[model samples]
Target: MRWSALLNPGFLVAFVVLTVSAIGMSAAIRAYGLHLQKLEIHAPGNRQLSALPRETPSWKQIGTDQIMDEDTVKTLGTENYVSRVYIQKNPPAGQEPIALEFHAAYYTGGIDTVPHVPERCMVGGGWLQTKGAQTLALEDVDTSTWIVDAAASGGARGEVYSVRTLPAPYSDAPGTRVRLPFGVAPDKPIHMRISAFGDPKTGKTLYSGYFFIANGGTAASAEQVRTLAFNLTSDYAYYLKVQFSSAGVSSAQELAELSSSLLGELIAEIMRCVPDWTLVESGEYPPDNPRRRTGASN
Candidate 1:
């Protein structure tokens, strides 16, 4: 604490050198961190909206994936999206066919977001809200397949093969199933919002259900989108906008129960559309695996 000690030339020079060195080290570390980001670059694949799977186990894609209008795409803020529908190829017993629609968008590295939901769009377009926002339970639908993409093995460019990997749904005894609605997986729960509206014009129940799987988890509601998409701990983020509708679905539970098959097969394909979080966290950016899904080993 002495004034003479503070004025000591040797101590003063050492203190100054240490302070400057710390500041320079900090800047260099920041630059190196930025450089590390550049190293984690993913080579693009068939992630384009058009590349969405055309068929699943029980459903056939109605047609090609639709392209959104320019204004709608601009409003959503990203073009990495797919707007498509699939029709049940073989409805059970006497049940009518089910048609499910899907729209998914992926965005990364930004905090800015815009609010867009089915309710808002429907009401503005003269639709009435028949049912309030509800958490529809998505039961487990076990669907798996083997994907042999020629691109992955550096063989022919367009030779992709498929093989059945796992047993079909309902293969297990009724005693083994969960009592509650399990979204994507048993260990990994996901959020799905199903809202019913009165299509007073068509007199048919308008069912729209959606959920989000971003980074490494899922969000059921819109409020979680911003937080999940732009967290401080990670540099990559993505969200899914899944909407399914059917005139024959009389109730929310029925819609959810029946959707198990279609969504079961479709969810894995959706994962391919987003960046792989496992690799992102480890700072490794390899080409995407077309066959990868939540529980698949290969």
Candidate 2:
């Protein structure tokens, strides 16, 4: 008696409504999945590695000539659409290791990993601040005042300042921050000495300096610089220091090249010691003097 009654017009209407609702929900879910896929891997594009001219310093006199058999470095992208940079140092050195800090961009897909944030990774009070995509400003947390020599010779003599601007980590944040961890806590202020000198005429040296920046009181500093110097060697590494006032490392495209001199000396030493070791993407290296285990990563 109920079979025919169950097949009423009302039942058909309810069935059609439920079916449509299910189809709509499925479509919405598929659309969201596609959106997330888009964020997972950014489109492959021109991810320039070194913005400035590069010099391949010789490590012949250094012991690296004997210990290192294969010396090569390649970077790639990893993590939430970010590049994870790594160096595979093989053959190995005994006590003295060779290291070099090869400059790179974070989002470049060619590398397996890159620094979490090249501009924000503070080492010795260095971080990058940005007003927008074009204005990549350097903020100094180091106590040392560094001078800037804008004019650099070589192919980079005319290169202008370029930056990859990023937004704040959180939507509600006040401003964006770039971090390159040098393990200097907010409690202690990092100290450094800085000076710049470059002769575009001879093209021997573009710039040079030593400086320091320490944390004021927090685990981090409010003022940071958009700069970093990575030690090429695995041991006793010192990063090139810069100040917030040291804006426009160059009026031309000489940021990487001009700063290369400062970094070149430091990196050359590392490579001399550890020929097999490649540059790390973490952008973190041990202080020339070894730190305690717990404090190493700091």
Candidate 3:
């Protein structure tokens, strides 16, 4: 018998609600199925299919040359979704800061565009200054967001590494390491000291430890990627260092706003570090920084 028939018009309404409740329960169970199964030492293999598309690429490779160099330091913010807070210093020509729209992987648009290149963490607004001058306030925006790279570490036998190698504008350079100076070891949890500066218009600075799994190109195992994300989430906290031009001038509202904004950005950045778990084209896509184009035209 059809389950909806048990109740007349009135009963039918109740039956619909019951059916919805059942569906919700089922969804909840499925979401945490892995967690539950592990506790009971039962392997829930093939119990449910993964939501990710099987056809998704293995890794996203940017030619390490597509990122704009002039906008070297960008704070990607994610409050409701991904946002960009780019800081520029004398951008050449094509390197002028531009804000492209952010689209999430789960979001549906006319066309299925891959999610924006998510950053590991938001390194709050940076200090823009000349060699001999103090940092100045150029541009500031609302708190922004960045994506966490959770899948880089192909689980199990794979390794995850975070680096801060540098030469200034490192994001746009191919095969360049600015500083391996700061990063967590493979399988270690991610942590960082986040700092910020604010004023009437000047925004804050947000920084965090780098955390990415090394999914050995085409040769990585699934376990390797999973382990990388697992280790990263273990240590998650925002150490925000507040930078202010003049102390006590700004009221609590201003300071609170800045603080809250910084925190939100931090969370979004961490999310980016999480592996997309989807395959993507691999290659170094460098940013088109005009400064790079001007050959010796400082």
Computed on alpha carbons, the lDDT of every model, listed in order, comes to 0.59, 0.26, 0.25
Off by over 4 Å in 1: 1-46, 143-184, 187-189, 286-298
Q: In terms of lDDT, which candidate is strongest?
A: 1
Worst ten-residue run, lDDT, model 3? 37-46
Better of 2 and 3 by lDDT: 2
lDDT tens string, model 3, 1-298? 8875765698878879999999998788655422221101000121111111111111111122123333332222212222222122233477532211112211111121122221212212334221121222211212221222344444442443333211222222222311111122322322211223332245432221111222111101223324422222111111111121113223323333332323222222322333212221121111222223432111
Taking all chains together, the TM-score of candidate 1 against the true structure is: 0.66
Q: Report the Cα lDDT for residue 197, model 2.
A: 32
Give the range where candidate 2 is weakest over 10 consecutive residues by summed lDDT.
Answer: 213-222
TM-score of each: 0.66, 0.20, 0.18
Candidate 2 residue runs with Cα over 4 Å from true position: 1-22, 28-101, 105-115, 123-252, 256-298
Per-residue CA lDDT of candidate 1, range 22-91, in tens? 9998798665432222222221463654555576557778877887799988987877777887888888
lDDT of 2 at 64: 21
Task: Name the lDDT of candidate 1.
Answer: 0.59
Provide the clash count, candidate 3: 65
Query: What TM value does model 2 have?
Result: 0.20
Model 3 RMSD in angstroms: 21.7
User: How would you encode candidate 2's per-residue C-alpha lDDT over 121-230 as one tens digit per residue?
Assistant: 32222332222212221222221222222231113122211111122221122122212223322233233222233333443322222232211011111122212222
How many backbone clashes are present in model 2? Answer: 64
